[model samples]
Target: MIKPTPNPPELDDTTPYEFPGSKRFHEAAERALDHYLKPNALTLRFHKPSTMFQIAPDQDNESLLAHACESLASASIMTSDIAAYVDNPQRHTILAIQQIIMLAELAVNRVLDNVEMARSASHN
Candidate 1:
């Protein structure tokens, strides 16, 4: 009878599987993946209204209305910007939202025009 061959040594989970020089390659790849995949914290922050539109303690009705108009105008611009980046199919929805924003902006502009006219008439 022939002698039985010995089994090869078992590799434990604690053993390093990487070849030489591969560790640095893997680290560089991980850094590149992280750079591309990581989301920006600043972009995820909640947005607040601009300080320019903030109401002062002594703000008048006309000034408040003007600020509202400016805010609506800004909203329209933002909606358009959002629509610009959207892909097809979903882009249609963004465009619809942009249209609604524009409508609201137009309505606010009309109100602002009427307020200005009244203010001018009163002043005269």
Candidate 2:
């Protein structure tokens, strides 16, 4: 019979992420451990970023930091999503970059919190 609705998707016995026997329920364990427990901790060195785009001086620090946090968050998501389609050792490199972006986003969030706290304290 030519019904209006299409056939339902077939169910699978297992999911792609069902690697309990392999990694044991933690997909990000290796990345998290590698990030925190590396021997001889790596130093964060900075290079001058391109000045082609910049926030206006009139913008408040909290707003600027908030925008930076959002931007880093987006970048981190992009790298992680792309990494899923990539094969190692390139996938490892992309994941590492995502980890770094996550760290930067966290730092920016911290600074934003500090600025907001100070602003509140000044108002009190």
Candidate 3:
């Protein structure tokens, strides 16, 4: 029996064009946070090892957990590196980038948490 893989969440390709005199940067960040926190293709990539470790009923989920930790760490490092380049703090583009960085941070945190939970559950 061949089951189809589920599709990941779609990433937006269009640029965000904020009108109304360049206000609402925080609102935009809030919306971005809400959207980015959801699991997507990006997150699923991190999840595959977790799923495989479970399905194979391997010796342990340690490898998968390590992978998850690595993914989060990589994201954090990349976000921090990018943050060094921003000059104007008030630009919408800057806000959007910040939102994206925040989302990345959130994703990493969730991945780590899920990995820990999986390891803990497996011990029972």
Candidate 4:
């Protein structure tokens, strides 16, 4: 089941952040949308005060915590695959992988920024 999201006051009447590399950033976003967004039908479910930290009593926050842990584990596994350069081992491929990793980090930062904004707003 899905719940309705409350309108975020911080997001109200505010322009989205236009960081440098916005074009490439958008291209990557489009790629992501085409890949995961369409395939998984991920929706933007904003948090509300009542539901922000909501959990079952016995092991209240375990589900959310476990989700985060599992995400990290998945990333680590993927990183090992990306770090593998046994075949040609060309410098260019290594450099390209580095760039990909940098871009991935930037994407993670953007996501964290959004999360931080939500968290800060929730504290208000």
Candidate 5:
């Protein structure tokens, strides 16, 4: 019968390794974290209370609708601009969002037009 050979150990104990530029790499990583990850003190101090849910009680519906239309139109334009530079995979999604914004703008404008017509008819 032939004798079988023994298998080697998983880890080698002979090599002593040292990474070059490790100190410089650590310093660069620390600087990047300090620059981008740390929160800004100025931003923390300038927090304003959100006005999203606070509608003025005295504002008229026509003015409010007009404002909504303007905001939607602006959003549509902004989305279109963003879509211009987006990759092909996400470009379609951004364009669809833009279309939705435009549709909302059109609806608001139609409501405003109807309100104006009703007011004019009442005055005549």
Candidate 6:
């Protein structure tokens, strides 16, 4: 059984773009693609922070931790207060949230104590 159209001629797969100085051009194209596509760690590290809220770079750790402890304590109190005003299931939820806040406050208090101890030890 003979076919109407014959088989197509075999040709070399290499294109004009693949020869001569194209190796350098290919490398440059790849680098350009990677630059746009890949997330660079250096860029991530130096990315701009939110302008609306930021802590002072010069702030000491002790003061920061102390503020954190106070904030967590206040949050715990607020959640307990809210729990008193809500329904049974909501109250349970609020109480659970309050417990989490209380645990955070305790952890912050421990860190504050450690910071104070370290400072005192360094002074002596």
- The numbered model that scores best in lDDT is 6
Instruction: Report the C-alpha lDDT of model 3 over 19-102, residue by residue, as the tens digit.
Output: 664457767787899787877777777774535335455645556555665765576566556656756563545556656756
Misplaced by over 4 Å in model 5 are: 1-53
- Estimate, for each residue in 16-79, the C-alpha lDDT of model 6 and write its tens digit: 5767799889889999999999879999899987878889999998899889988998999899
Lowest summed lDDT across 10 adjacent residues in model 4 is found at 39-48
Positional deviation of residue 119's Cα in model 1 after best superposition, in angstroms: 1.7
All candidates: CA RMSD in angstroms?
13.2, 15.2, 22.0, 23.2, 9.9, 14.0
Candidate 1: misplaced stretches above 4 Å?
1-58
Identify the candidate with maximal TM-score: 6
Candidate 2, poorest ten consecutive residues by summed lDDT: 39-48
Candidate 5 has an lDDT of 0.87
Which structure is stronger by lDDT: 1 or 3?
1
Clashing pairs in 3: none
Model 6 residue 63 CA deviation (Å) reads: 0.7
Stretches > 4 Å off in candidate 4: 1-89
- Output the better candidate (5/6) by lDDT: 6
Tell me the lDDT of model 3 at 29. Answer: 82
Compose the digit string of candidate 4's lDDT tens values, residues 47-120.
33466666556763434444554565566556556567455566457556556655665666566667678879
Residue ranges of candidate 2 with Cα displaced over 4 Å: 1-54
